[model samples]
Target: MEWRGRRQSSNIEDRRAEGPVGGGFGGSGPGGGFRIPVGSGRGGGLSIGTIIFLVVIYFVFKAMGIDLLQVVSGGQPTPAGYERSAQESSPGEEDTKAFVATVLAETEDTWNGIFKANGETYREPRLVLFRNAIQSACGNASAASGPFYCPADQKVYLDMSFFDELSQRFKASGDFAQAYVVAHEVGHHVQNLLGILPKVNEQRQNMSEAQSNQMSVRTELQADCFAGIWGKYTQQKGLLEQGDLEEALNAATQIGDDTLQRRTQGYVVPESFNHGTSQQRSTWFKRGFDSGQLSACDTFNNPV
Candidate 1:
């Protein structure tokens, strides 16, 4: 949106590889490094060696009952591929990285203002731009896993290639739609700051599988609404172009639980849906954008 010449957020960590991607071998040359597998494709599934390594690590931590999110999200003792760092993104991806940082900075500014007005402090979440695969507080995930926010370490994981897929494969083309995806993940971070995640997790632990899925749907929808809040802010700032709002709406509908399930599995299971229906997602987002108030995004209390 009104992002031209705006100060980009320094909190972002660009982790996109400069070399090979189908192998997750960039930024870290070959030879026994920790790697999260992408699903069902090259550079996706865990090799036997990786499996053994993770098993050993898992047991070591299990003995101490230590949470691994810290290590995963912290990216220290250093995640294998952060060597060159974000500053070293290839010339090709440099623009994309900058744009992502700008988006993050805008979100920070908007949220910071909201928090300040409410007499609260807002801690900005870091955005990790990675490709192929990444290690996250949530676990080792791949670009295929899509963008996600890990509350354990308070960071967002993104793969720039997903934007290509968003426009090309999903046919949801528009800069604003791409922005919506990142904003949605950021919304999850907001939920974490508000204690919604821990509460939801606690409730999920005691709920039936079906009920848990419904809870997840609520969580996803709320994130969508939060994304819409950002969209409203961008609109006010004169950022949206012709059809930009519809592009985001179209993207929201394209990635709904029902749609993804049908595309990936050739079937849809309502009770198994963790994200809401396409209509539900678009509606919640529209509600948030129309209200332009964070208080309106209470999917937990409102019927989906």
Candidate 2:
């Protein structure tokens, strides 16, 4: 994406290449203590995650009179030392930081335009660039947690090296692909502003595991569609070069929950899924791309 001249968002916090991993995320912010796991995070590198979504599910459902043990079978906790701070960046790391900053700026602009078009004000989401691990209002998380949005904090967390997972592991590479990931998280921020996230979470609390996963798939697919909205605006402003859309589409397919689950675990279980399948992801994104209208991206009202 051609993001050079855009306005960089002040909401971005440059925590990318600093501090060791594994510090306490609890009480790290003002007026905290809200326990919720916004999304299922991928562990970056070797650092394990201390607070997984299952724990969050357990605690969140405890409040709703649901036993998490019934739904969350078992998964090993992320190893210790996973929470340590990240090492200092090398000399060339500045370029990567700038790229991420530029991406944030683009998302800010695109979303701002979108909000204005709908006659509503935009509430920018903060982007936290951390090292191995960082503390959030939702919980303490490691880079292994990959990128996630904490609705409680209204912030987006990312460890840029996930680009590696995107490129080397998932085989989805290119600058635009990386930018797609950022846009997707910002899309969640959009959902939060639209009051879609809280309601979905509430509904999920009373749902069976299969039902909750279905809701999550809808949520994730909508975010993908939102990301497509951002892409449409950017492309209109002359950001598209040949293959840019393919890069983004590849990214959407690469991160599909079903695809990730099949690779991370042994097989795919539709009912246990959080993010949608690759086909659903690709389809929703294309829906948003084809029709740049935000309303067109409603995965909840219309089945995906």
- Summarize candidate 2's per-residue lDDT along 103-147 as a digit string, tens digits: 788888888887898899998888888766677878877655667
lDDT of 1 by residue, 1-304 (tens): 4566878999987666443223332232112111111112123667889988976885577456543433555633323323444555578578777778888888898788777988989999998887677776667766666677888788888888888888786777877888888888888888888888889988988999999889988998998998898888888888778888999899898888777676666777789877788899899999889997888999899788
For model 1 the local lDDT of residue 200 reads 92
Candidate 2: minimum summed lDDT over ten consecutive residues — where? 29-38
Model 2 C-alpha lDDT versus the unseen true structure: 0.74
lDDT (0 to 1) per candidate: 0.75, 0.74
Model 1 segments beyond 4 Å from truth?
A: 17-20, 24-90
TM-score of 2: 0.77
Candidate with best lDDT: 1
